[model samples]
Target: MLGERVKKLTKLMLTGLTMALCVVAFSPTVKAEAAMLQESEPNDNPAQANQLPLNTWVKGKMDDEYDYDVDWYQFTIPKRGVSQIEMIPDSTNTSGAGWEVSVQDVNRHEMLQISGRTAESYKLGLAPGKYYMKVSGIHQTFVDNTHPYNLRINYSESEEWEIEQYYENKNFSNANNILPNKKYTGNMYSERDVDYYRVKINGKQ
Candidate 1:
């Protein structure tokens, strides 16, 4: 009877040890899976603005943490130039809310604001200095975390060649006349229009 009781006790100990080992092996995997389901949050205010460089594009997202989420970006133009700022939302963003973009000078003065449901862009002649761009959802309704946007900045130093209206040169065959190494400005009234230019190259190297 004593030997039988000892065997039963040993079997119980072994069973408990096996169950503990299984728990230890699978706990980390369970925790890891839980972590993978969580989404990352972006910087919300101007104080955590992301720094951007000229002629570069960045990706940003909106989250549900706040009623209004604003993303800030800063860039510096080394010389007096024309700057083109563009913001395009992802097609997967089915949220009916639109977005707003605002540009500000280094002194915190608002320079320009663009708002609409579609992709938006702004071209302006800015002085050589630092500028900040603020992006937010319109009417505080943008809360889709899965969708992101693309922001780009393009700048070119002010050139001697100036053409205010190049509407007729919408195609390569009807390219606007221009001088080489000169900057020109033209109006892009609509999204369907393209501005084409023909530059005269004087000599070959």
Candidate 2:
């Protein structure tokens, strides 16, 4: 009889210890999982805080001419940021001697001149507000081919970099201020009624 009683007492103590361990293992007060969940909330909308100001773009087409000046390409940014400008040739179009891009700061009277091939781009980081991209056709007028050119201008602070590229020909040197291998696929021309390059403002994230 004493042996049986001892066995029963030992079983009861083991059962009690097991229950105590289970309670400690799954305690409600020590919620490690819930604490971890709270940590993920802060970074959810980190990009929303860096939103860039609104921007507009204007596009224009140039016909065969020695100096097809585009003085009307202008706009104002509500805030200062980066500007990406491209003088792309219409995919369905062709150029005889290619086009040239230039800029003149309204206040400083400074000028930047760059020549572009069939699909080339020029990017500039400038202060906010009014600026101009004075585009014209290059004069290899000796070539008897009709040239039609297109332009694209994008402005944004959220973009990774302000860059330009060209790929119509196989020239791969950075001599023309062109960023190598940055390919672009978009509407080459924005209709005849469109008279200026298009600008886009990217949101910060």
Task: For candidate 1, write residues 7-88 as lDDT tens digits.
Answer: 9999999999999999988886665422111112455655666787777767666664453567788788787557777767
Give each model's whole-structure lDDT: 0.65, 0.44
Model 2, poorest ten-residue lDDT window? 35-44
| Candidate 1 positional error at 78, Å | 1.2
Compute the lDDT for candidate 2.
0.44
lDDT of 2 at 119: 42
Worst 10 residues of 1 by lDDT: 32-41
Instruction: Highest lDDT: give the candidate number.
Output: 1
Pairs with steric clashes in candidate 1: 159-183
